[model samples]
Target: MPRFAANLSMMYTEHDFLDRFAAAAADGFQAVEYLFPYAYDATELRRRLDDHGLKQVLFNAPPGDWESGERGIAALPGREAEFRSGIDRALEYARALGCPRVHVMAGLVQPDAKPAEHRDTYLANLARAAEQAAAAGVDILVEPINGRDMPGYFLNRQADAHAVVQDVGASNLKVQLDLYHCQIVEGDLTATLRRDLPTGRVGHLQIAGVPDRHEPDRGELDVSHLFGVVDELGYDGWMGCEYRPRAGTSEGLGWLNDYQGENA
Candidate 1:
């Protein structure tokens, strides 16, 4: 069976952030993930996870100037210092949360930005972040956000993300393969899974409905079948339910029961 982690950032928005932990756990989710944890103290967040019996599976390292429209700094030249500092902060939280992985966002590319410079900076920063993450026993992940949701984002393709991981060549560096973005960018998810999961470089996985980003049960993608594919591939990582709830977070979870493992 495919173990799932509820994404608190998108789901459980009806409740306060801290309270969302319990909301997810009550709905039968064993683990949780989110976009960032910088706004809250790690201790407080860890307390919620412990209280709710939820494992913190994944979260992103700080993205640069989020309110100002800057998505990430990992690929931005001259922001290396800030990026490295964010890695430290994320790893600190990862340790506190007992999380095994962290996603490092590659920044957007501007018309004036040099791709070569950005690529060099990204690889160097990831290599450095991977080194830092290694000592903490936490893996660093890079995700490919599709152009529709994040225009001009540096990493937009699974192939590109995998290539970046290969270039970094860090045992701890891996791809956060989000199937929603994959379907938007390059469908045939089953084939992609067959090709990529065998690589053993995919650190984490995520999913949502195609075109709408809603509950997986109603999506164009057959998420239930994909769940079986993930099982067939022997993927041991948690598949994150990173989608906006069509209705109440709990009300829409009727789909979850179909995929729940016997022990879940």
Candidate 2:
């Protein structure tokens, strides 16, 4: 059975940020993930996880000036210094939380900038990150975000992300395959998983309803069938529920219950 982790950043919006930990545990999630953790003290975050008996699976390294619309700085030229600082901060939290993965978002490609430069910067930065993370027993992940949701975002396809992993040639570097983005950018997810999962380069998985990011069961995708495929493929990492609920967060968890109930 695929272990599911509630994305506290996207789901569990009904509660305050700190309060979401208990809510997720109360709702039967054994693990949790979120976007950023730099705002809180690592000690307090660890306390919450221990109190609720939840494991922290993943979190994003800081995306530069998120409120000002800088999605990430990993791919931006001349920002390598900032990116490294962010990774250092992220690993500090990861070590405190006992997390194994840290997601590095590729920043948007400037409209008139040279693509080759951004690509070079991204690969170099990731190589450095992987080396730094390896010492801490953590893996670095790169995800492809669809253009519609994030226009100008670099790295928008699975093949592209995989190529990056190859280019970097770091064992600790891998891809974060999000099914929602995959469905929107390239349909035929079963084929995608079949090809990618066996490579040992995909470190994490995420899902949401297609066309409108909601519960996995509510979208055009037969999430149940896809999940079964994941199991058969032998992916043992966490499946992040990265979606917006149609109604309340907990109210839209029937899909989770259906799968977990059967497995339990």
Candidate 3:
């Protein structure tokens, strides 16, 4: 069976972080991922994970500029220092929360940016970051967010992410296959995953329905079918539920219950 992990950051906002985590536990998830947990106390997060008996599968490196539209700078020229500092902070959180993977997002692309230059910069920085993460035994996962969702983003294709991973040539660096974005950008989910999943290119996974980007039911993705396909592919990683709730996270969770019950 494919392991299912709820992304608490998207799954809850009504309660405190720990409470939201407890809810995921009570709902029967064995692992969870979050987008940004650096602002919270690492010790507290560690305690909560321990209490809930949940594993931390993935999270993201800190954004360079949360405001003014700058997201991440891992591939930006002249920003290596900031990117490394961000990785250091993420390593601390990964240690505290027992996280095994961290996604390094290449932030927005400049309007006149050259692809070759950006790709070279991304490969160099990712190689160094992967070395640091490898020393800690944590995988550095790079993700390709869809251009439709994240306008101006530099890396927005699974092929691009896979190429960067190959260029870095580090065992610790791999691609995070996010199905929601993949469906948007490529549409042929099964074929794409089949091609990349074998290269050991995929380090982590995230999914949700496309179009509205909500729970599986609100869009075209047959998430249960997806789970089955990946399961057959022998992927033993967490499938992160990284979607915005239509109304609330709790309500959206019914989608999982429906799929799990049927697929169970």
Candidate 4:
């Protein structure tokens, strides 16, 4: 059976973080993922997870300056110090939350930042971050946000993200292939996963139906097909439901049950 993780940050934001986690456990998610949890008390969050018996599948690097629309700063030039500080903070939080993976958000580019310079800056900083995370037994996962959803952000493709991991030369660094973004930027999920799995490039996964960005069901891509393909390929990782619910998250969860069977 494919283990499911609720995206509490987005799907359950209406409630407090701990309360949302309890709700997710009540709804049957064995694990969970989210975009960010910097403001929440890490130890308190851990206590909630312990109470609910939930594993944190994934979470992101500290998003810098949310008011300015700067989602992440790890890739921006002239901000190496800030970026490292962010990584450290994320590691502290990850440890408290018992998380094994951290999604490095390649931040939006500056108006004058050259493409080549930006790439080099991101690679260098990620290498350092990966080295730090490696000692902590955590994998630094790079996420490629689709251009449509996040314009001007560097690193926006699975192939490109894989390349970053290769360039970093840090075994602990890997790629986070979000299916929703992949569908928009590049379809053929099965083929991509097959190609990337052997390299250990795929460290984490997220799913949402295309176009609407809702739960997977009667959508452009078949999540169960992708799940079966990954299972056959011997991939053992949590598939996180990171979609915005069309009505309620629980309503859409029936799709997964129908495809995965009640046994799952």
Candidates' lDDT values, in order? 0.93, 0.95, 0.86, 0.84
lDDT by residue for model 1 over 28-143, one digit each (tens)? Answer: 88899999999999999999999989899999999999999999999999999999899999999999999999999998998778888899999999999999999999999999
lDDT of 3 by residue, 192-240 (tens): 9789888888988888878887886677888778887898899987889
Clashing residue pairs for model 3: none
TM-score for candidate 4, residues paired by index: 0.95
Q: Clashing pairs in model 2?
A: none
lDDT against true structure, model 4 = 0.84
Q: Which scores better on lDDT, 2 or 4?
A: 2
Q: Can you give the TM-score per candidate against the true fold?
A: 0.97, 0.98, 0.96, 0.95
Q: Which number leads on TM-score?
A: 2
The sequence of per-residue lDDT tens digits that candidate 4 reaches over residues 1-264 is 567789986677657767898889888788989888877888888888999999987998887887779978777788899899989999998888889999888889866778898888888989999989988899998888888888888877888888888877889898887889988898888889889887777888888889788877757988777887878887788888888888766666788778667445
Q: Is candidate 2 or candidate 4 better by TM-score?
A: 2
Which candidate do you rate higher for lDDT, 3 or 4?
3
Per-model clash counts, in order, read 0, 0, 0, 0
Ranking by TM-score: 2, 1, 3, 4
Q: What is the C-alpha RMSD of each candidate to the true structure, in Å?
A: 1.4, 0.8, 1.3, 1.5
lDDT pick, better of 1 and 3: 1
Worst 10 residues of 3 by lDDT: 255-264
Model 2 global lDDT (CA atoms, 0 to 1): 0.95
Return the candidate ranking by lDDT, descending.
2, 1, 3, 4
